[model samples]
Target: METILEFISKHIEMFYLIILMIFVGIELIGHVPSVLHTPLMSGANAIHGVVIIGSIIVMGQAHEIISLILGFIAVIMGTLNVVGGFVVTDRMLEMFKKKK
Candidate 1:
């Protein structure tokens, strides 16, 4: 849509920063050993909670139906991701716990 295009144009710098960060994150993760992946993913899940909040804000402010629907879906997916990440992290950490 025209509005989306205009918004993206106006915030092009933000988009560039986001893209750059994505690549940087991927590169960093690529170098991490398998042992550290669980902790890293747990941290990412906390960060994704922020994404859910952002999506909620978008859903609240979205005037167009399509935008609202997309935002809602984003929130749902983010929630699922965060919850799953925490569960996996907990299971991984449990293996290291000493017997009582």
Candidate 2:
């Protein structure tokens, strides 16, 4: 569609930056040691908590149905990510404890 193409053209640089970030993130994460994973996951969960709060604020301010729906989805997904991260971190910590 012309509109889609126009939108893509208008934000081509952003697309390129996103692609670059994806690759960089993959490379960085792939190289992280397993011992550091728990800490990294905790940090990621903290970031997602902030994202969830921000999405809630956005949803509160949204006047359009579409915007509110998208914000709600973002909040749900962010909360899931944070909860999952905490669960995983807890399990990883358990693995380090001595078994009685």
Candidate 3:
């Protein structure tokens, strides 16, 4: 466990870059089947809700004010994306509703 922690501590930035790349790859090439895409995307949107809580967690561990500020910004962006995603999804569903 200590060895793993040491390795991670030594390679924090590389791990971050690799994770970022993986997510980018997922965005670019991880096509979902039509039937599952909307549901998965909505589920993914729910993930953004974690950002604000993450910011608070980060704030507790922050070594500098800048880190706190950046965390706050991330929280704001994540919240906006979560809310906007839901709103757009609702509009899309409404488009398909049969009108009287």
Candidate 4:
């Protein structure tokens, strides 16, 4: 674990690059058409579900109160986002259905 932390500290530039890439990726996603947003959001929500799983794993391994609290918050927020995404996607699809 110490080795990992040392490596991260040594390669902090890589982390910065990754953060920049993430922001750029988010900006590019914003350029997607309105018609595509719902599907993309649903996909993102599925990814967030994976994030929740990771957070749960982290929570299980957490030894400190602060880490536990942060992990729990991550799980809760991810759940809310996923549920909200599904609701929005469903509503968007409903508009495309032929009305009786």
Candidate 2 on 1-100: residue-level lDDT in tens? 9999999999999999999988987987898888877777775675556667788888889999899889889989878877777787777767668656
Question: What overall lDDT, based on C-alpha atoms, would model 2 receive against the true structure?
Answer: 0.81
Candidate 4 ranges beyond 4 A from true positions: 1-39, 42-48
Report residue 12 deviation for candidate 3 (angstroms).
21
Per-residue lDDT, model 2, residue 93, is 69
Ranking by TM-score: 1, 2, 4, 3
TM-score of 1: 0.54
lDDT of each: 0.83, 0.81, 0.75, 0.81
- Number of the candidate with higher lDDT, 1 or 2: 1
Model 2 error, position 48 (Å) = 4.1
- Over the stretch 34-94, how does candidate 4's per-residue lDDT look in tens digits? 8877677685675556667787788889999999899989889878777777787777767
What TM-score would each prediction reach against the true structure?
0.54, 0.53, 0.48, 0.53
Residue-level lDDT for 6 in candidate 1:
100
In model 1, the Cα lDDT at residue 35 comes to 81
| Candidate number with the higher TM-score (2 or 3) | 2
RMSD of each: 5.4, 5.4, 7.4, 6.1
lDDT of 1 by residue, 1-100 (tens): 9999999999999999999999998887888878877677786776667677788888889999899889989989878877877787777778768547
| Candidate 2 local lDDT, residue 20 | 100
Which prediction has the highest lDDT against the true structure?
1
Off by over 4 Å in 3: 5-43, 46-49, 60-63
